[model samples]
Target chain A: MLTSCTNAIILTVNGDEHMLVVEPNELLINVLRNELGLTGSKYGCGTGQCGACTVLIDGEPALACVTLAVACDGKEIVTIEGIARPDGGLHPIQEEFLGENAVQCGFCTPGMILMAGDLLKRNPHPTEPEIRHHIKGNICRCTGYNGIVRAIQHAAARMAEPAAADGPDLVKEAR
Target chain B: MKLESYVRPAGLEEALAVLAAPGPKALVFAGGTDLVPMMRKMRMNGTLLNGDSPRVILDLSKLDELCGIRKAGGMLEIGAATTMGVIAADPSVKKLVPVLAAAAASVGSPLVRNRATLGGNLVTASPSADTAPALLAAGAVVRLAGAEGGPRELPLSEFFVAYRKTALQPGEIVTHVLVPLAGRPVAGRFEKVGLRNADAISVVCAACEIELEGSTCRAARIGLGAVAAVPVRALAVEAALLGREITADVAAECARLVHEHISPIDDVRASAQYRGWVAEAVVARMITDTAREAGA
Candidate 1:
């Protein structure tokens, strides 16, 4: 029989590796929010229904609420805090969300942005239905999803262009 | 949940040994989509500590042997720990069993599918499980490995004994699901009726695989979910379609026979009468679509 013991797990979060000891029952969201203080990923619902606690594990969008911290040992995690430009600028998706007025209460914004980023990475040019379908797991009470859908489409269009062709200034001017 | 220990076994043998051990209660952990929520509910209800013994979560996610998909000798062998996202996106699965792939794609949502495993879905034994009907229609079998014996295989039809119950014995873990590939060309379709398009549990679901010779049905397999205690095969419906020239009228007639075989119950998502109607409609649509695709 196995005995109760704290497990030392290694997690590479946003390119930084942290070696920490955690209890077996500790959830990934708890460790991230409470231990690391990466509060960008919200805890809207403890259940997996709400995608508010979504984070990218090995480049796939997974629910952190249901994921145990021990199971994520030695895996690379990218929370909403990690989803920015290298020079401390907002990502295209984030900019588009702002430009499109997708953020209402902002509770669902982080997860929505992360999910939109993951979707664009997989499919650079997604149709409107595909974009809506991809982000179906995320729930937004205020926006009614119209602004979010528009923002994702705009992000897809912006991301499809060459790096030098479009600048963040254009998004700022539009907003 | 109050898990005493989280054991990530390095190998399948070690996992089996841990499960076969006498004292502590070990719950097999895969994609935590189902078990974690259930555990949390149990914890909330203060039922997690019913027994004095400590609880261990035997995580099988790290085992590479349980996380792949391959084709061997006319069977698509999917590892038990293979995520639904992988299965849904797999090219091999799409080509061989498109219905299964579609069903996988229709499960919960992208976030849930990224971690939910095929074996976990079967072991949870939910009657509304999306993949169960598709796998049933494809005539899949599960390979089980226990500590005592080497390994054994059981048909997917026999895997579920009742509602929320499976034939999985203690100390035994599902290794892989083997879906037989049809030698001849076949057309299969899967349909799910839920309150919403995504992340909604099926009110009623159906899958149909039809092999046609000219205009006559050579072989047919129909599987239904959420219309019974367990995901079931509509054997009577299948038998009715065999050797018959499938048309709109004939499909409608056979779809009505599904009501005779299934016994659905009223749940939160739908009423029993609504499920019965939806089941017939879905089965009819599946039959007609599959037959058309099979060049009927």
Candidate 2:
């Protein structure tokens, strides 16, 4: 049996730093939802099978459920709640996801948006297959996945427009 | 089910100190992709039975000693803690061992690949580990480091002993996987038959590597998974292909030999009979495809 240990850690979540005490066994999803009240990242499978708990750890897509809170110390975590602009504006990907009618039950939207954001940031212009491949982990039982794929593609096009007129400066401001 | 302590050792020695501390049982977690879920299930089962689960998790993700993908001394050395995603995208690794890269790519999904480490996959010793078949086909050597022995090397074929078990001794951990690239020009291919195209555990997976000389096979290796207690090299299949021109007839014989060699049991993923059939099919397809790629 492992000896029980709790640790105090500083977590940088969504540009805000929070000092919290966590048990070694506490998962990042629970810490994000219960401790900090950032419930935008949902717990779907709790086994990391579903990507509803996906968050950006240093701009990379990561499942928060399987990830231990203690392991994520000192990393920058960006949840769905953190993607909104300071002026109370929805991020471009969020705007596009809504515009493309990608929300079915909205349970998987946060993860889908984050995952698409990750893909778009890495590849400004991705083919349909690439977008589909990126979000394969994030399951959307509703909308038949066609709309989700279309939403990610649309988000990619909007994000790569090189104009801040219609869309927020997502590439610069978000990351 | 309570976790006792989470230690992120700065170096291998510090990590060994925690592992050899002589108190609570400690387990090494590289990415925690497989370990975390297994731990959760164990904790739940333990709570029901009033038993003890792993208490200490020695997080190895932060250790620089166990995290990299590079070529050194004419070998492609992948650190044990290197994530599957990085391995899949690494240019050098992809160029040297395309089959390993493909196997790494076929694992789970993007999110899982980002967190699943090569060492975690091997140490878990899952018969269906996607990377194992390819690494086994490539003739990779695993490097182990311990508090006592310092470091040692073992062929990947000898690393796995049984289901979910490895040859790792107490306080010893995998440090790097070395893929030797000194011999003949080799071409490889990896194939997986699963319930879905992506994010599904393998019903059967195969990795085939071939060395060719003007439409004749000089050497061949076949690794098959999910058909036995451990990932196995298909020696019978390799024998059928070596020193012979890879052809449709040879491929058919190799398939039959694959079925003869594997001893599969009926599991939730597939029936024993079905696994046997698919195992041969995957190995056959991979061999033919890899041979064709090499112009055999």
Candidate 3:
């Protein structure tokens, strides 16, 4: 009975390990927001298609709203809150987004920024079409996307500059 | 989101062992893209039968067994857990099975593709699914596995028995999809009409695979989605184009047959008449593009 009653979910968010006891009906988004106090992620549609709930699972951007909390045991997870360094320095993507003026009232900004970060991590210098293609699932109700596109392009340049210097060796394999 | 029980196994063997036990206690998971939304559906019919409080939540994330792509004998072998983003960007699939890549690239968005798996799409078995029509045209096959036995396979066309239905047994899960590789020498295209674009379900869609040999119509296969209860092949058009000379007249003939072959109904996204017209127009356009790609 002791072995049979084992229940544990291990999560490592932004290199931080978290152990949780989750309800069978709990979602990753709800757990992150309600339990762990990481509420930077938004819940727009409660559906997977909307990128509002996007988070990185095993270093890959995933929809957290639809993800079951129990499914993330001993796996790496990342949310909008984790994008910044502990010293209060912003990630290159965050700096680029602010510099390029990609935020507007910014309800969708958290998801947008994280999704862009995920895309740049995978492809440092994505084409215009590729940039659009990558963010297609993350919708923006305000600022009508000019700023988002600009932000993505700006981040891509910064990301690609490093990769260009180090070449393919600098490129981390996508999970 | 609250769950009663959650189980994460290091791999498939461990996960399957926990799932094999008999109880209303468990539900298996993947991208969670579709399942999470279904739980919150406002008007969508049929919720996941696992109930609100499953005793077992088996997380299969550690199973690397169901990821990646392979090519052999002119067939594209796609792992069940292979993300749509990976498939869309894979150069091999782009060059050989471009239709699949095109369909993959068109799915939801980059974030979705980063997590959405091809196996998840086919397993969900929505009649309007974007990739289904493309895979159907490519002569795709489905491979499945269970706790007890060896892997088994089935034709992708037959995998969808009906609307919101599948041929998968309760204990089994899909493992992969095999689609024939069509080189540049051939012609094919996929077109879908959705509510808006980017993450909308198809109101109507069509896919065609064709070949042109020396100005003569060598062969063709057509697949339609959301125009019926299950995605159906355009046998009428396929029959009409076989051995026929490439011409505007041939496209018109194929378009005519396309109308007769499909049975679309009025739904929230579109009317039956609009679906019929779009089906015809899409068939004609696909033929035009395919023949043009053939360089004649």
Best by lDDT: 1
Candidate 1: misplaced stretches above 4 Å? A1-4, A165-174, B45-54
Name the lDDT of candidate 2: 0.85
Query: Which residue pairs clash in candidate 2?
Result: A2-B55, A3-B4, A4-B4, A5-B4
Q: Pick the candidate with the highest TM-score.
A: 1
| lDDT for each residue of candidate 1 in B212-240, tens digit (9 for 90 to 100) | 88989988989999999999999989999
User: Residue A63 lDDT in model 2?
Assistant: 94
DockQ, every prediction: 0.59, 0.49, 0.42
Task: Report the candidate with higher lDDT, 2 versus 3.
Answer: 2
Cα deviation of B91 in candidate 2 (Å)? 0.7
Q: What is the C-alpha lDDT of each candidate?
A: 0.88, 0.85, 0.75
lDDT of 3 by residue, B1-296 (tens): 33345565666666656766776635566676776676555124423632334445565544677788988666778888888889998987787777788888777777777777888888887778778888888878998887788778898877888777888876677877887665543578988788886777788777888887787777887888888888888888888888877677679777888876678899889998999888888888888788888765
CAPRI class assigned to model 1 = medium
Evaluated at residue A16, the lDDT of candidate 3 is 79
True contacts kept of 3: 0.70
Residue B34, candidate 1: alpha-carbon lDDT: 87
TM-score of 3: 0.86
